[model samples]
Structures are given as structure tokens and as C-alpha cells.
Target: MTQKKRIVIKIGSSSLTSLHGEISRRKLKRIAEEVVELKEEGHEVLLVSSGAVAAGYRKLGCVERPTALTEKQAAASIGQGLLMEAYSEYFLSHGYVASQILITRTDFSEEKRYKNARNTLKILLDRGIIPIVNENDTVTIDRLKFGDNDTLSAKVAGLVDADQLIILSDIDGLYDSDPRKNPNAELVRDVKEITPEIEASAGDPGSAAGTGGMKSKIEAFKITMASGIHAFLGKAGVRGLLLDAANGTASGTYFTPAEKTLDSRKQWIAFNSGPEGTVTVDQNAKNVLTAHTGELQAEHVISVSGRFKNGAVVRLKDENEEEIGLGIINYSSEQLQHFRELDEEAKAIVDSEGLVCRIDVPLPATI
Candidate 1:
């Protein structure tokens, strides 16, 4: 790493588990050592790891991984402390401090709390402390869950405006076809854009211990790419993997960011602060917003669905009920239903100057 960079590494449960599907100390030590080396080289590192369930299930006196939600949560409660203890011990031996941050979706949904998390992480990173992040599975409900840690890692990468995100898995890289099914599957070493074919080829979790598979990784890349953060997906436990990925020479699939990126404010609006409702607009407004060169006006809004207060993020849809993008609406659902035209005095908005309706964030392209 020639220039100092902020990097986030996501390690899945499969990478940290043994053949019997339990936490492996050797794998954890290897990851911690590489991270310490990265820190010594003047680079900031944040880890988003998933192994609580794997580490705690056996301790819960189970023969294998538990499928029930309550059982999973119980396992996490037992494993989180053990996982952190190991991480702290390894990092402390290397003369470094490791802090733990366990968060749920609500932390990112509320703007105030989101900014606070960002600020806290910024302070830790500045002080040369590596913040290890994980989803607070003990109390998280399915409705507010992030689905998988892969999604959590991508969101965190955007939260800190990381320069790059490295996702470590058991697979070496993405293949055109399922390697297990097809004997001659070709590894896709570089990817500039995620095409429809690529999305279609993404399959379910390959390992019994993992929750998110190739599909989840692809979805995670969409968030990073939209935020203008480069990302790499590669096999874990490879020697010098972190350094090589940062230097752009790793044996993995690299994802290039979009030319136009969303800033911190926009990223929060787009990826976090989950939409409260949908605002339907005319075809013309939808076209302009997705094209990256347009502003939304109250006159263009045809209708509003769902109850949302003013200053809330809402999904922007078209006449046909197709989602175009998302933005912070100035008027509440009740207010928009009452009147169509927003006068200048009310400050409907102008290119997000008065903060009325800002909808420049683009969604992923569909086939």
C-alpha cells in the first residue's frame, strides 16, 4: 500500500470454521496477523466477521449448526465474547488494540444514530485502533435483519467511505458456472460491470456453514460500486492476500466502481435509512432522475403510497409502479395527497438546494 487507505475485510463463517463446522483458532490467528501487518504498514483496517453461531453451537451442546432462530441467537450470545477474546488476544500480542462494535439495522436506519456510529468509528480509526464489526444477532429480528454479514460489510464500507473492500471466502473467485457442477468452469478474474448473465450465474451458499453465497456477494458489490469503493472477492487463508488485494494483484474477482459515485449523505439515503414509502412520479421525471441529469418537482409527482413523515426517505416510482430511485421527500404523505403544486415559499426544492426531493441515486440495472 503506497498511499494510506481505509480497508474493510469481510470474513464469513465458512472461512473460520473447521471441517466439523466449529470455530478454528488457526484461521483466526492467520487473519489477525495479516491485519496487524496491514496496520504496521500505515493502513487502517476494519473487520466484519461472521463466526459466532459456528463457535457457539457446539458449546450449546448441539451436534451441528442450529436452524432455529432462537437457537442461532443463543449460540451467538455465547460465541460473541469468545470470538472477541481471541481477536483481542491476538492483536494485543502484536501491540495493537482491537475494539468491538456490534450493531443492528436500526443503527443505520436512524440518521442521527448512523452519523454517531460513523463518528465513533472515525475516532477509533484515527487513533490506530482496528474496530471489529458484527451484526448484533442476539437481539435482531428478521424484519430488521441485514440478511447476511456480506451486506453488513458493504454497508460499513460505505459508512466509512473505505477505499476498498476485500471479502474473503472459501472460493477463490467467481466462476462463469458453478464449479462443482461444471468441471470446466472459468474463473472471472476481473469485472468492470456486473452484467445480467453474471447476476443469473450467482448461486446459493456453497458451504453448509455459510449464510450468504455468490448471490449475496454480488449484491454487496453493487453497494460498494455505487459508493465508488473498489472491492475484491477471494479465498481466505491465502498468504499475503490482504496486501496483494490492496495493491491490486490478488488472485480474485475485482469489481470496479461507477464513474459517478454517491457521497456520504447520498450513500446513507440510498443504502441505509430504509425507505418508508413510495412516491410515484411521471415518466419524464423518472427518466431524468435515472439518467443522472434531472431534478424532481412537486408537479411531477402523480401520487404517494404508504404513510411517511416529512424529511423521510421514500422510494421513487413511476406510473407503472416501477421503482426508479429513492430520495428524501419534503412533503409528508398527507401533505402530498392534499396538494400537487408546492409553492416557492414552501421551498419544494431546487437541485437539493433547499432539500425538497433529492433523487439522483441510481438503482442497479435489471435485465
Candidate 2:
């Protein structure tokens, strides 16, 4: 028997929407059936699905997807319920329970809330329930939005520590060039690392119903791979695609990082926490920080930029202003500056547990 695995599958709007830009029951049912099969095979499944705005725009009397933030939010408010009803009904028919989980960027930004969300998902998955996740688009402001479900799915996979992240899209797989513009473009089967050449090959969104393109998917892969999770990108609606993906036999682009992977706390510090200030350290301090030999000392701080409170995330920079890592500041920027001027005795400015170096993966952009 195949080993049981925890899997997170993300289906984009384009895959679930009909040509009329509305949710397709046929597509939803097909996906539900596949998920049921996976569950029956003794694997845990979590779904991150997109299509709320597309599913409700017509009900809002719009001819096309709404561009205005308020309009989109209104559409999502209406569509999210409808989308959940469909999923719940379909899964119920297959003797499985489906639960909805609406998330905002703020949920992950706050450490307490992030841990709570992870704990909740763990309970649901352990009880054999499929957790259906999506951005809380109805209430999320532009600044707090996840932008697309592609990245949200990757983050969710990392949050749940899934064995695999399967992203089903309109395209078959990653290509060496834009397949639409270049008919002879070749599909890349396996990728151990994302190179500049691979990033250059990604293209824009292929469908009006979808927000994420190949570029966003590549970024998502970087997150998952760095988290030590294997991922697959392939065409939606392919026969037994989910099973094939779990079994490592799927015909799609596969991303597998090198041996090392970040721990949960490091993943949070690297991807979710928003830096509130910059902390510049001299070369000696930089060496100690990078070596993970000791905690940062106030005496090592060259300068502190921006205002932030204690326990807030801060960017650690070298004297040359190059970003080296991120850490939770033990003192506020003002306090650190005061200590620098006073030339006081050495004091710990950042504990070792709160620091995450950028040597593993690029730090997430600040909110």
C-alpha cells in the first residue's frame, strides 16, 4: 500500500469557472469525486479553492468580473456562501464533510492568530474533514489581501506542514517559453532550484477568471520548496491527477528544494512577519549573527532606523546597508538608539530563537 500523505490542493478560478464566467457544477463535482477517492485511499486532503467573485458576479448583475474593490468585496460576500454550499453538498454526497476557512493576511501576520489557525486546521484534518480555504476577500482591505489564492495555498501548505502541494491550473506545466506565443515551447518536468532563467520563462495570467499567472505559481513554489514540501503544477481535470501527484507520477513541473528546510518558527519569521524597522550592525556583529553563535548585543548595533515596539520584527542589515536577516527586536528602535548613544554595557538586543537568516530563502516583502 502507498504511504498516507497530507496533501494541499489549490484549484484556481479558471479551473472551476465556466466560459460564461460562473462556477461550473460539473467541474466542482469532478474535483469533489477526486478528493473523495484520495480520502478513501487513507490520505488527508485540504483544498484551497478560488472562484468567489466569478461565482457571484452575475448575481450582482455585472457583465464581467468587478474591478472596483467594493464591488469585488460585495460579489465575494455573496459568492463565498454559494461556493461553500456547493462544496458542502457535493462532499456530503460522497460521505465526507467539507469545512470552510476564510483567512486574511493579518491572520498570518500576527503570531498568536497564525498558531491558532494552524491548530484549528490540524483538528479538522485529524478528524478526516477536508478544510476548504480561501482568502477572506469580503472584508480584507487592499493592503491586507493575499492578492491571489496561489500564494495563499502555498502558505496554507506550509502552515499545515503538508507532504505535498498540488496546484492545478489551466496550463499543463511550466514551460521553457510562453507556450501561447511559442508553439514549440517545451515543458520542464523537474526543477531542483528556481534559477533566473526559469523565472524569466514565466508568463502573465492566461484567463480572465484568474488573477495568478505562472509567475505567481513560481513564487509559490519557492515558498513550498523552501519549507521542505514537494509541489506539482499541472492542468486541471486530468484523470487521476491528484493521485498521480501524491504518488509522484504526475506529468507536470515538480519542485524539490535541496536538503535543508526551515523550521516552523523560522518559516513564520521569514514569510509572515512584517518588519517594522531596520537594525544595522557592524561586521563583527554580522559575523556573530550569521554564525548563530550568540544573541545580538546592543553594543553591536551601528544604527537603528524607523520606529517600532519591543517584540516587533526588524530587518537586520550589515553596515553597508545590505539586508542580512530578520529578527524580533528585544528593544524598541528608540531604546536601541538611546543605548547606542549612551555606550552602555553590552546587552542582548535580539534573542537567537527570534532570528531567521536570509541565506535559506529570500525574505518576504514587508506589508
- lDDT string for model 2 (92-117, tens) is 99889999999999999899999999
Pairs that collide in candidate 2 are: none
- Best candidate according to lDDT: 1
Best by TM-score: 2
TM-scores for all predictions: 0.92, 0.93
Q: How close is candidate 2 to the true structure, as a TM-score?
A: 0.93
Task: Show model 2 residue runs off by greater than 4 Å.
Answer: 344-367
What does the lDDT come to for candidate 2? 0.86
Local lDDT at 10 for model 2: 99
lDDT of 1 at 140: 93
- lDDT of residue 288 for candidate 2: 77
Candidate models: Cα lDDT each: 0.88, 0.86
Report the backbone clash tally of model 1. 0
RMSD of each: 3.3, 3.1
